[model samples]
Target: MQQLLVVGDIHGFPETFVELLDVGSFEQRVLQLADLSGRPGLRGDNLHDHLVKKDGLQHAVRALRETNGPPCFGIGFSSGGTALWSAVKEGLEIQALICVSSTRLRFETSPLNIPTIVFWGDLDPHRPTEIWNDAVPECCKTYAGKHHDFYRVDALAPNSPLRTDIGAFIESVSGLHSGGPAPAR
Candidate 1:
């Protein structure tokens, strides 16, 4: 069976957001970074400051490494995505990656070998630049909202367009619709 890992943003995974994804069939694992400790209210500069001071991303990468096992599909939000990307670079096995609003990836220049996709809101000021988008191995999609909008409680309506697109992408990457194995990008 396929394993699916979900990494939360700095604010951690909200219950509503968790319910938005379709992971019923896969063996799933969820990570809430040590820095946040399940906190969900931090925002703006406070969030950035706290993460930087706590070396949150590095901790997250460590946590991922400890849990590392067979190749799996990964979904990460914001800083969590950066941690996963870093973990992949450090040799944690992953078949594919889907990152949402992971603006920090703008600094990554090295190409990833596996299939990967990224999602960001068009209105998010911190969204990655054209150069990063162009360099990524797979698709980069933009939604019509600000940063964090896609995962917000109000935006997680069951059939929201963002959720639909994300679900479709997961299916395609995991080969859920096709009997064949996932593709190598």
Candidate 2:
């Protein structure tokens, strides 16, 4: 079975994280990254820098290294997505990446070796579609909604279209078991 590490936005763990990851196939397991906020040592000043670099990516690495398991998959939203990519950029291994509403994606010269799927709302003010398109190519999925629209707390589950897209994307990469899936036409 595959394990998925869910990284939430900077606002902390979004309620949608659990429900959204629940839509995956049984072969995949879900682990939502802990919201270190509201905790004693992690509460104030430089929180972003602290978690993003020295302290942040470790969570994923620890999760993957626990029990000497295989490289776990990643699902990140907004800043969480940034953390996921940062882990990869810093040499942490991930089987695949599913990023939603990510504003900044550090592009390197080497063609990305991992399979990546990016989802940005058509109405998101963060970055234009062209940027995401250029970054992820055909692997980007644009929905008829906004940044926070992909997942909501009160709903019984995540949006249906998003669910289907996520499930399909996960399955699409099952073959690689390494990098991201090819762009879907």
Candidate 3:
């Protein structure tokens, strides 16, 4: 089976986020990347500072490239998405990308050629602006809540529309439900 790379937000993958995704089903086939130091519980501005202001993003890209050498499907949350994006630009092999609430992408002028999708809440003030959306309107999806809704258990119940959509995307890209061989990485 093809592996999936999951990158967590600055807060890391909270229990709620993990539970909502029922990640255990594919736990063995998933490679999860988080804080640059592999430390837990880093949040808010401090984590942002470490990741962006301190060259941690480059470190993360390097770590990602070293940890997962083959092309694969990826899901990145917030700043983690930015890291994944950078890694891809810097030659990390990734077939597809799903970025949720990666607001910092607003500054990205270059487009990624791989199959990619971005999700953010309608109320997220920091979401990419019209220009960014215009660059890839079809790849952008908006939910009804605010930023971080994807990390909230209550906001993303297993049966919720957002969860269902995300599951479908994963299945489509990974061919998990097709009974056929997944595409070559």
Candidate 4:
């Protein structure tokens, strides 16, 4: 598999995000890029232009396009998640996408066919389960926590279902050899 780019949140500290990569066993396969602006974690407006500027996605595509490795699989949370989507919308072409708590995606229908997974909390105040259900249907994974609970903290649990599922998804996507567009999940 190629490098795993952990796009830190605009509000997230670079140090904390690096720690998260270490805990997730992804530190070894990282794509070190320019310093990310803003804080880490989700807070709506606080993250957006500061975290992923309008051309950030395009920049990542150009930067990684010449890399000597297989396609990348991105894991984003909250605002980071939506930014990844925007990147895909801008034709970033990641191998796979796993997003959690990217609220307000119920209105986005830009024809994403990648091997995508969208996690929905049972008690999310932002987007309801039905919304995610209607959006990805077969690709959505439902968790037993609130919106905030879907953060990397929940993923840190050794026996967490979210962690296991993410591992499996990454493995599966990494093995893909066809350069064709990802099929619907």
Candidate 5:
């Protein structure tokens, strides 16, 4: 059985992601990255560049249960997706990464140990596909609409087409166990 650990944006959207996971039948074995926010959505005085480098994730690395075994896959949605990429880059033992409507951080330059799948919305202000392409080796899944179209938070809006290919993408990327590190000069 493949265990998918779905991570949502650190800013806001943990509940939305959790609801989606439940609807997707992913109730067990999913991990949500917590926010260190003293007040919800309040980022405080931290520098913008270091925003995603959360102490919560760092602690997760230390407190993770080695007994449950490695997750078969990791799904990073929005900002959490990038965090997952960073965690993998920092040597976390994950099999693969699936990033949706997200960008790659500057530190994510080298080719990763596992394959990755990136989902991008054409109008997703974030311009996910463009960022991921420049930094990571991922199969890009582009939607004809915006970022929120891919998300099923409250409900799938009429304009948002059903994503029939995500499961397939996950299957494909998961099968690719090894890939070369990003090219070095």
Candidate 6:
């Protein structure tokens, strides 16, 4: 029951955020660099580069579904939140969802009955807090801060409250972890 965490829309952030990942860091950066070098990486292109990470997330989810261990918690950031919501709606067994700076991709009656936490940077260029605040269900909580504030880089040091807020939210909702063993894909 290892909970599979699926991250969302990293875009080109991986190119410089190599220090974040503990595993597959180099390879992931190389792939992102390759994708950025080509025209396919442009926003909304829906090209081969997009599918690369898309496949990766899907594979990760499939593996988590197959695992039979401690109940796992899944966290999705930014566009990753969108994907997480999709998985939950599709009936993918997950303990929880932590979406940051993102929203639902389409308008549908979501089947996501699980506890969901949303972290939106107040000043994010794309997914601002106002856009997602009312859109998400009450079960989901949105943090008001700045874009990339979660990473705590110098650019966002002024709005460091987001980091602490996220930590607190996780602690508050962790007790609600539930659902049976993740189902097979």
For all candidates in order, the CA lDDT equals 0.68, 0.57, 0.65, 0.55, 0.51, 0.43
- Where does model 2 exceed 4 Å of error? 15-68, 106-111, 128-132, 136-138, 153-159, 176-185
Candidate 3 shows a clash count of: 0
State residue 18's C-alpha deviation in candidate 4, in Å.
Answer: 6.6
TM-score of each: 0.79, 0.66, 0.77, 0.65, 0.63, 0.52
1-185, model 5: which lDDT tens digit per residue? 55676665544444543323212333334444444222233332341223445454444433333315646667666656666777677666777777776554434565677877666666766553455565665556556655643564322233223233445544454443223222111
Best by lDDT: 1
Q: Which regions of candidate 6 fall more than 4 Å away from where they truly are?
A: 1-8, 12-70, 104-111, 128-132, 139-145, 148-160, 176-185
Off by over 4 Å in 5: 11-27, 35-68, 104-107, 128-135, 153-163, 173-185
Write the residue-wise lDDT of candidate 6 on 1-185 in tens digits: 12334343445332333222221211211123223223333543353235344564454334334434444455555444555566566556766665655543324343357766555554555543443445554343334455543443521244244434444444445532223221110
User: Which order, best to worst by lDDT?
Assistant: 1, 3, 2, 4, 5, 6
Superposition-based RMSD of candidate 1 using all C-alpha atoms, in angstroms: 4.2
- How do the residues 1-185 of candidate 2 rate in per-residue lDDT, one tens digit apiece? 66766666655545343445433343344333444322223422354555555565466444433423567777776656766666676676877888776665534233246888777777776644465476553377666655543544312245466665666677777653324344353
lDDT of 4 at 178: 30
lDDT digits (tens) for residues 1-185 of candidate 3: 44567777776554234433432244322333445535344576676777777766777888887764456777777887888888887887877887878888888886787877777888888888767876852366777765654544532566765555566666666555633332221
Better of 1 and 5 by TM-score: 1
Error of 5 at 160 (Å): 7.6
Residue 70 of model 6 has an lDDT of 46
Error of 5 at 80 (Å): 0.7
Q: What are the per-residue Cα lDDT tens digits for candidate 1 across 95-145?
A: 888888888888788768887888888888888777778776487777765
Clashes of each: 0, 3, 0, 6, 1, 8
Better of 1 and 6 by TM-score: 1
